[model samples]
Target: MLGISFFSVVSFLLVWELACRNGVVDPIFLPAPSQVLERAVRMFTEGTLLWHALASTRRVMVGFLVATMAAIPLGILMGTSQRTRAAFDPILSFLRPLPSMSWIPLSLLWFGITETQKYSIVFMGTFAPALLYVIDATRSIDPLLIRAARNLGANRWQVMREVIMPGSLPQIISGFKVILGLSWTCVISAELVAAKEGLGFLIMNGKEFFQTDTVVLGMVMISLTVLLTDIVSRVIEKRILKWQA
Candidate 1:
């Protein structure tokens, strides 16, 4: 599988490079892989590429972590209680439909042009979805498990700890992996306006200068970063979900 993937990528790049060289595609619009690599090397040597990547990564992690921390307990509560779910349903309905970009103006007003504003954008964008995922995961737990725990003289808290939490955890983790990727999109929206450094900023800057190679490099960096984070998430998932294996 790895060999096939490698061969496919190599073939695609060869075709792309040849198309540019043969004038079948405009270099200004879509540069060759070699040109994108050159831009990457230049950015790395100038010490901007890593900085931009780290900036975006930091924003994503902070925002995502905060969202997860808040969402889990609340979602569990809502999932377990009809009243709680009813109370929050309207608010979730309102927030869930809104895009990350829609919050930019309010976040800027609330946090100025600071890093907190960027974090807020990511937080707002991801929090509702993460909460919904957790709620669903929690609610998916078998009623029989809860009843069995209760029959064994387990209290509310004990039942939750022994039955609901364990039952829901695997699905929650899977949902969180997806939300982590969504956080990247939120961070990009955050950076596009007020950020001085981030892949989104790098891409916008490249566009203003008509440096298509730099723009492509920025996109590639985002994809590579997301891929790296997904690998890490998979490792962590394995560790946490050993029972599943």
Candidate 2:
């Protein structure tokens, strides 16, 4: 696996460098791999690259955590109670179709071009769908398990906490993994308006200056960061869901 990964990356970089060097692709439109790497190195030495990457990462984490924290409980409640489900269904339906970009206007109005506005955009974009995923996961728990828990003298709250929550946690975590990726996409939209530093901002700024290298670097950074985060999430999931795995 390590060998394959190394070779694949090496081959890609080689082909990319060759393509630009040989004029198969225009450097102005798509900067050479070396140019992008040089920009990355310069940015790193200057510290702006790290700052932009961290800013975007922080936004994604904060928004994703807040959205997950809010969604799980509400979703569990909706799944467990018919009344709650009925009350929330229409609202969820309304919000679910709204894209992240749609929330930017209202978020900016509410938070006024602050970091909070960016976080709000991501939260609003992710929350509805995340809640629905949790609800579905909760509902999919076997009714027989609930019945057994009740028969064993578990109260409603006890059953929810001990039986339902535990039963649904694996799926909930999996859903959050998907939501985390979505949050990154939302971060881009969030930065589109007024962000001064973030991978998204870097990309936008690069475009205005016709610096394709910076734009490419921004995109590559996003993908690499997402991959790293995915690895962390998977490790956490494995540890948390040890019993199931």
Identify the leading candidate in terms of lDDT.
1
Q: lDDT per residue, candidate 2, 1-245, as tens digits?
A: 99999999999999999999999999999998999999999999999999999999999999989999999899999999999999999999999999999988888778897999988989998999899899999999999999999999999999988999999999999888999999999999889677988999999999999999999999999999999999999999999999985
Per-candidate Cα lDDT values, in order, are 0.95, 0.93
lDDT of 1 at 93: 95
lDDT of residue 37 for candidate 2: 96
Tens-place lDDT per residue, model 1, 121-204, is 989999999999999999999899899999999999999998899899999999999999999999998888888889999999
Give me the displacement of residue 45 in model 2, in angstroms.
Answer: 0.3
- In candidate 1, which residue pairs clash? none
**Model 1 whole-model lDDT (C-alpha atoms):** 0.95
Q: What are the models' TM-scores?
A: 0.98, 0.97
lDDT of 2: 0.93
Residue 68 displacement in candidate 1 (angstroms): 0.5
Residue 203 lDDT, candidate 2, scale 0-100: 95
Worst 10 residues of 1 by lDDT: 188-197
